[model samples]
Target: MAMTIALNKAGKRFNRDWIFRNLTFQFESGNSYAIIGSNGSGKSTFLQVISGAYHLNEGHCTWTDGATLPVEKVYRHIAYCAPYLELIEEMTLLEFLEFHQHFKPFVAGMTPKKIIEEIGMQAAAHKRIQQFSSGMKQRAKLAQCIYSDVPVLLLDEPCTNLDRQGIDLYYTLIDQYAKNRLVLVGSNDEVEYKFCTQRLNIMDYKSF
Candidate 1:
């Protein structure tokens, strides 16, 4: 079944200042979209709106997959990765993966070990995440975010701590795992969203 995330006249404000207002858009499954903007331009907030992490102040948002899905159940269908979202540093890479599976299953035939191996972090699988390097931590984040079996994938600054090799790996994972899903990348860097066919520049939607 096809899925869609629709917003109608949506608006949000913080401290009497509207970040974005009077926006209407529908995001369909099987397509990739880029939310481009400078830092503090509400790109993250906009993604959260679509992800049902935040509510609209003026309009409405809805998700539909054959039928409308309640907001409470939206998290089950979405996999989100953001720079600000922290992992449980106390858990090992493998332990974290095992813990996450209790909430969201990985892609079919994927085990925690396999996932760590796919990211080339098999050697550190048993090491606590707090011991991982910045790039390594980012890889762990991407492994969990991209490998999850979910229809909606939301990424914010996905390549933040990645190097050239890590960036290549990111694209590879996106190309292989993101087929036929709703992928939204929040970033201003072209490299981060180069594969996205559709683009929404946040500056264009900043109507107060």
Candidate 2:
């Protein structure tokens, strides 16, 4: 099924500060979107609202696949990754992916061992995540989130600590795996979201 997400007059705020308001948009399966804005412009907050991490102060966000998905179960269909989101540092690369599968299984034919290999992290598979370099840690995070079998993928600064080669691997995964899914990226760097088909600039809805 092609999943769809709709936001009608969506508004979110903290105290008197409005992030974005009166914004209506739709995100459909098989397309990728970029949430564009300068620093501190609420890009991440907006994505979180759709991820069910925050509630809109006003308006509504809906998920559908022919029928409207219930608020309580919407999370089951989405996979998210972010720079600040912590991983199980104590777990080895092999162990982390195995642990992830218990909650969100990887795509069919994909195993924990396969995911580690996919990210070229086989050399670090037996080491603890905390012992990894910044680039390696980011690769592990991406492996767990991107390799999961889901329709919607939300990435906030996905290439945070990646180097030149690591960045190339990101696009490789997207090309090979995310073609049919709904991918949303929050970033100002065009390189980070160059593959997205749509763009939402939060400044268009920002209020003082």
Compose the digit string of candidate 2's lDDT tens values, residues 98-161: 9889989899899999888888888899999999999998888888888988889999999999
Worst 10 residues of 2 by lDDT: 114-123
Please give the distance, in angstroms, between residue 180's alpha carbon in candidate 1 and its true position after superposition.
Answer: 0.8
Candidate 1 lDDT over residue span 5-113, tens digit each: 9989989888798888888898999999999988899999999988898988899999999899999999999999988999999999999999999999998899998
